[model samples]
Target: MALGGILEVVALFIPWVTFTLGSQTASVTFLDAFSKMTSGMDSFAAMYVRFLAFILIAGTLLSTLPWTLGALRTKRSAYWFSGIRRRELTPPNFWWYRTVFAGRATVMLLFHIAGIIAMFYEDLSKIGLGAYLLLLGGVLVIVGAAIGPKLTAAR
Candidate 1:
């Protein structure tokens, strides 16, 4: 979870730094113009960078749900399995937690959906369907990961 957060923060800064540098060194050289518009700033560039940051942050957070849940299940069940029976027994417990993880994952999915919708509403012309698809796929995977537990529980 901490690693996920760190990665998100790092992703948020990438575009900001790239565009900031690009703007600042606008006249320095071809690369400079490509990197920045002014010595330290560019409103237009900053806006784009901010959008990119949001996408990165959302993507990271949205995907973290299932990753974190799986890690937790593995950690929780690691000690219970034996050499020979490990594979058979471990799967049951791991799957049992899916119901719990599903609820959590659903919340994360909703959050991602809202963010994606907001992005489209904010700038209809600029919104990319690719982003929405990516978010949707991430949500579906998380939700699916949690489905095993529910199915087992029903039985």
Candidate 2:
């Protein structure tokens, strides 16, 4: 469920980023940059880039779903029900917590990598919404990876 929430947030960010980018005036360099972005490139390249982005978005959500469902199973498991807490947690299980957390970590890692890639290839002058996304995503990944386990263990 945690993973799901994180992924859903990222998926939502996509159209938001696209709209922001679309609304902005393209610099002469923006046009020129694309012109020099591999001479043989076609609309197909744009399509492929979009497709890759879509896959990353979908993969984040898809990976998260099973972890969400597993939360329910964790609640029902006998091991989880026996004094795990005074009141049951939403997921109410240790393993489930770890699994969901690890899934979240996985998504964060993926996001971090993607952000680095975008940052590397990006024209600094054109850095805008995408740079913000990358920055935020990188921070989230670092925080999650560094602190998430401690939170889980405390529970």
Candidate 3:
């Protein structure tokens, strides 16, 4: 799950699509694609795309936070939070984490699926590594969240 979240974040900076025009080829990251694609569009369409991008970014970060916090709290040197006491930083149990992760993952997955569908409307661009990574990351988180509790309980 942690890996998935990290991958999703990393995917933003890598190429998501590649465009080939006869003899020339160009690859663009998520931000690059967003800027280039929206630059010439009408306000309504641009706004819609912006909204989806915002949701996708925000959802990925939000969903990843709990797992990160939980991981941090488990470390021996995790007392890096300036003034906050150590006890206050302790995370909830596996079930709580699993539930929160699953819920957020589901929402992120929906937006990601929507984004994938939106990509089909574009012309002459091949989906790139970053997009596939994003999809894989979302799936990993969802699957991890769903089965994590059972696996932990079995041990």
Candidate 4:
């Protein structure tokens, strides 16, 4: 999850949109598109890509924290944060939480799917290196998330 999120974020720096006319070609990255927003130019696609960038970061944090922290505990333990206080935790180890990474990948909660959809719908011809990386990285994340749990349990 951490690696995937990092790659997704890095994808922002690579060329995602391309344009061509005659013998000339130009390309832009997510950051480039995003910066355009405050420069008197804004597009729905850029804003949506910006949102997906944030989701990737947040999702990485959520998934990594539990896995890293859970391993240090002597036994399964969780300290929940909520309004006021809770009398007790349902259990030390929660299975539902384990599904978060998988869910994010499967549904593409990080917004890679949306990015892909938006790209294909808006301008297929303009897709470039970064867009291809985004699609490939997204698929890797999904496959890794799906297999990671099973691999851990088997050993």
> Which candidate has the top score in lDDT?
3
Off by over 4 Å in 3: 37-49, 67-100, 122-125, 147-155
| Overall lDDT per candidate, in order of appearance | 0.43, 0.42, 0.63, 0.55
lDDT of 3 at 85: 38
Cα deviation of 113, candidate 2, in Å: 3.6
| Each model's total of backbone clashes | 8, 0, 0, 0
Evaluation by lDDT, superior candidate among 3 and 4: 3
Off by over 4 Å in 4: 1-3, 38-46, 64-98, 149-155
Error of 2 at 25 (Å): 2.9
Which pairs of residues collide in candidate 2? none
Off by over 4 Å in 1: 1-75, 78-96, 122-126, 149-155
lDDT per residue (tens digit) for residues 1-155 in model 2: 34434543453333222223555844322223333466454544343343444455455445434443443245455234232343344533445454454555476556544643553454444444533553454345434433333224344
**Model 4 / residue 149 / CA error / Å:** 6.1
- The positional error of residue 30 in candidate 1, measured at the CA in angstroms, is 24
Over 4 Å off, model 2? 1-24, 27-48, 68-112, 115-122, 134-155
Worst 10 residues of 1 by lDDT: 11-20
lDDT per residue as tens, model 3, 21-134: 999998888777676664556554354355675677566656555454444344443334212233433334445555555777788787776676566556424678887888
Worst 10 residues of 3 by lDDT: 81-90
CA shift at 106, candidate 4, in angstroms? Answer: 2.3
TM-score of 3: 0.62
RMSD of each: 11.2, 9.5, 6.8, 5.3
Candidate with the greatest TM-score versus the true structure? 3
- The alpha-carbon lDDT assigned to residue 18 of candidate 2 equals 26
